[model samples]
Target: MKIRTRLSLLFTLITAIILLLFATAIYYSAAKDREKEFYSLLKKEAYTKANLFFDADITQKTLQDIYKNNRKILNEVEVAIYDTRSNLLYHDAVDIDMVKETPEMLQSIHEKGEISFYQGDWQVIGVRYPFQNEYYLITATAYDEYGYTKLNNLLNSSILIFILAILVIFFTGIYFSKKTFDPVRDMIKKAKIISASRLDLRLPLKDNKDELAELTNTFNEMLTRLENSFEAQKLFVSNTSHELRTPLTRLLTELELSEKKQLTNDEYASLIHNLTTDVQQLIRLSNSLLDLARANYDRSKITFKTVRIDEILLDARHQVQKLNPQYKVNICFDMETEDDSDISIEGNEYLLQVAFANLFENGCKFSDNLQSQVVITNKEKKIQLTFSDSGIGISEKDLKKIFDPFFRGDNKYFTEGNGIGLSLTKKIIEIHNGSITAQSELNHGTTFIIELPI
Candidate 1:
């Protein structure tokens, strides 16, 4: 069943049970009150009859006449009086015995001041009266016809009201439940219409601060991330295509020219050399692209270990120098620390090395002295590293786009690079829960600062 229907049924069932129990209690209390009131009336009638029967001013005939006259007022009432010896003394109704009089019954009445009991549908009351040094037993019995009729009417009315209330509650529950989930229904409809092309669309927000509003906010945030990722993926593909086409087109053109011409051996050798250079450029671009893609992967899929940041930096410096022997890298500690963990961080060693290597290569390749200087500092549970070079620095406008993929600045002519290094470095650092920022002025060179939690 749908949630609305199920909630409605559950709500109705619970209310119905409570109403049933309450109605039953009210009915039971009313019945008990009626029985108690009727018994009191019977007891009063019996005592009055006894007083009239033993009165010194009234004769026996007159007492009988009074009872006969009051017979219609007390409906179906029977009264009897007996001496202590169990001998009948007076009886208002001689034709019908509403209650059976026994010696045990008289003895009970004498022991107790008064007693009340039931005989079939009749309510019976027994009283002990003292007159002229002798005690008499008086018993009265009557049926509460009016009270029973009223009780039956109340039970029927209660059942009718209970059924009506249950129906009203069932429908009311449905109405309220529908009202509550209307916003959710609208949200689902809006979400269905939001395709990849329409990522800018957002769910409507309500004024009240509720869970549904919070859910909408979370969904909008997720959509924002997805939209950014899609845009990045598109840009990456376009750049990769453009970068690969240049080298491939040059290789194809050179090969075609060599095939169409009758060249000297030296010309052929130079042509081959040129082709080799183009192929090597293609290989480097492909590798950078692969590294960038790898860096964008979820961190959970990457292997992480406790590796020293200082060790990774040293390794990166060595690798850069091995590739370009003219490049010089100097590494030094800003502050001495006895704790080994001060320079240690939890990260993927390979990715960290890749990021550091890019920074080192950029620093040396862009500097006029062909050198990079790295300073490491450990403070506040973080490892901070600065890579500074005295090179033709980036302009203010170009610095902002340094980490963008395929974004080469005005210094592009000063060095041969695919422009993927800084972008890939940024992704790798982010994956390791680190931050990288650059500060530079034209002619003053540039410095890249990185912080990683230890």
Candidate 2:
């Protein structure tokens, strides 16, 4: 079902339940009041008879007739007189069960010399009156026969009322639901229309500031992200095709010519090395791009454990030194203590080490023209690693694109990079709830700073 219909049904159901409770309370309350009034009337008449019955002159027939016929005109009430021996003295028409004064029944009698009792189908009110003579009077009225005959008729008529009320509430709910879901439905429909091809179109936003307004705002944000992702994917495909075509074309040309022309062993080795290097760079670029894509999704199973930041930094430094022995690579351990107690962090030790290594290696590659220096500082709240290079620094415009996937600087053609180094670094930092940034000046050095929460 549509959201509008479901919401309407929900609202209508809730309102109906509340109405049912209210109607039940009112119906029961009216029935009790009617029963109480009748019981009171019978009690008064019985007390009058006790005075006239003339226990002082029990031989009088006139008082007995008056007592027997008293309150007989009250069609809904049943009056009974009890003697001192707990026997039924006299009674008028009785429809429902007459309450008898057993020890349990007497225990329930109220302070007002009356008792009120209810079983689901019957409500009874009984009042007891005492006389100076050797007799007691009891009066009772059944709510079932009195008001409930008319009440049952009224309740049956309310069946029609219940149907009408439900119809009215259901229609009202549907009308409001339509009004509420109109703009949102429109936005969703528009969203379904747009894809990577039609990203320029945006959904309409309503003016109202209710929940629907917030919904439209959220939808707009989603569209913005989709548009950005679409653009990035397009750019990445274009860059990848362009980068891959160069090496493949060269490899093809070299192979074709080598078959046609005689070549020395050294020349053949040089060609093979160049081809291998290009292939390796392409593979690195592909892997980095995959990592970048994967990082955007949930990492719920990315388990973490206690890993020393200094060890991770040292590993990355040692690996970079092994790769480029030409440049001076220096790493110093400035830990407060070598014990795990003094320096510590919680993360996957392997991934954390890879991230540090990527940053350090990238610095070393860019600094192949000069000395490369790196420093890692472990603080109480977090760990900060700074990798500085003496090679060409990033220009003002290229600074922002440093972390963007496949973003290569204009002046760094001599250096080697797949352009996803900083991108992967940023994603790793984000996973650890950390941050990474780049600071560089032209002709001077570039320094990359990373901070990770402990």
Per-candidate TM-score against the hidden true structure: 0.82, 0.75
- Give candidate 2's whole-model lDDT: 0.69
TM-score of 2: 0.75
The candidate 2 region of ten consecutive residues with least summed lDDT is 92-101
Model 2, span 1-454: residue lDDT tens:
9988998899888988887777778778876676666556656655555554435455335554543465454344444555544565655432333554464454344235676666454445555665653335364544345566777776776667777898899999999888877777787788799887887787777787888778778877888888898898898788778777877788888888888998899989988997887788778767666766666556687778888777777776676677666656666554555567445777767667667777667666666464676676776667777778876778999998888877888755857676776787788888888888889998677888878886
Q: What C-alpha root-mean-square deviation, in Å, does candidate 2 show against the real structure?
A: 5.8
For model 1, state the Cα shift of residue 319 in Å: 3.2
What stretches of model 2 exceed 4 Å from their correct place? 46-160, 207-209, 264-270, 283-297, 333-335
Candidate 1, 362: how far from true, in Å? Answer: 1.5
Q: Which residue runs does candidate 1 get wrong by more than 4 Å? A: 1-7, 42-141, 176-180, 261-272
Q: lDDT values of the candidates?
A: 0.90, 0.69
Worst 10 residues of 1 by lDDT: 56-65
